[model samples]
Target: GDVCVNTLKQDWSPTHGIRHILMVIRCLLIEPFPESALNEEASRLLMEDFEEYARRAKLMTSIHAASASSASKKKATPLSVDVANHLVASSPKSSKKEK
Candidate 1:
């Protein structure tokens, strides 16, 4: 994960807002970070056989897209303030120490 998205990284800063975080996520989706991949097999496939990896990723995207479209058609519920606050609080903080 990128520093902006991974709060545990020393490079991470509390100053980064949602816009910056989303941009980093979009960049990651466009070009994955295989070096820090949680799925070793997928990462190895991506590095060793890019064509096959792309084919599989496309297939999975289409499959999930169809499901997501149907799910989105249903009424969405707004996040409660408590849940939102909890999520913000639970997020990891940067490990950097200030002098």
Candidate 2:
């Protein structure tokens, strides 16, 4: 749930690279906070029901974890953090204000 939404905008040096960037992206993907989302719900499916939201989030995490593990075993195009974020954002749903 550690989202570095403004990491690049902060006072940091170039010691960080693509991996770091991807990590932050991945964090957002895994724990998207639509209610407090910087993108204003554009990057997540804000469900009205808390239980349903939790269920969907868990499913997504499991899917991503599985894909990441499989990708880690291979040498070709390993799953980067960015890829994870894309999956979260691309989830098939719409915005619903949390109750």
Candidate 3:
């Protein structure tokens, strides 16, 4: 899993993917973070171009939301208790001050 995602304070770059970029842009409209901007140019554009900002923001939110909602609705993989038990049983104990 990508741990850096949780720590991100800026929008996704184009290389990350179009949807990812949109999600970040949408979030910026919901709440701009100029103080912690990784892309000064983008922040400037968003602030100066209100109409475009709002338009893209609205479109992205709707498109991303539907896809994200459906993705979230899918059932998560169930944990295998038997495999877990076998793993624990097979693992050797740590070296300790034991007789």
Model 3: lDDT to the true structure: 0.53
Cα deviation of 7 in candidate 2 (Å)? 1.2
Per-residue lDDT tens digits for candidate 3, residues 1-99, read 121232243543434544454465677557767555556655576779878766876887886665766878996543222322321222234323458
Q: What do the candidate models score in CA lDDT, each in turn?
A: 0.65, 0.58, 0.53
The estimated TM-scores of all candidates read: 0.56, 0.34, 0.33
For model 2, the local distance difference test gives 0.58
Tell how far residue 77 is off in model 1, in angstroms: 7.9
User: In lDDT terms, which candidate is top?
Assistant: 1
Model 2 residue runs over 4 Å out of place are 1-4, 41-99
Candidate 3: stretches off by over 4 Å:
1-31, 39-41, 67-72, 75-99
Could you list the CA RMSD of all candidates, in the order they appear? 11.5, 16.1, 13.3
Which of 1 and 2 is ahead in lDDT? 1
Model 2 C-alpha RMSD vs. true structure (Å) is 16.1
Ten contiguous residues minimizing lDDT sum, candidate 3: 83-92
Candidate 1 C-alpha error for residue 7, in Å: 5.8
Per-residue lDDT tens digits of candidate 2, residues 17-79?
A: 667777777886777656656543343546455666667768878866657668689854323
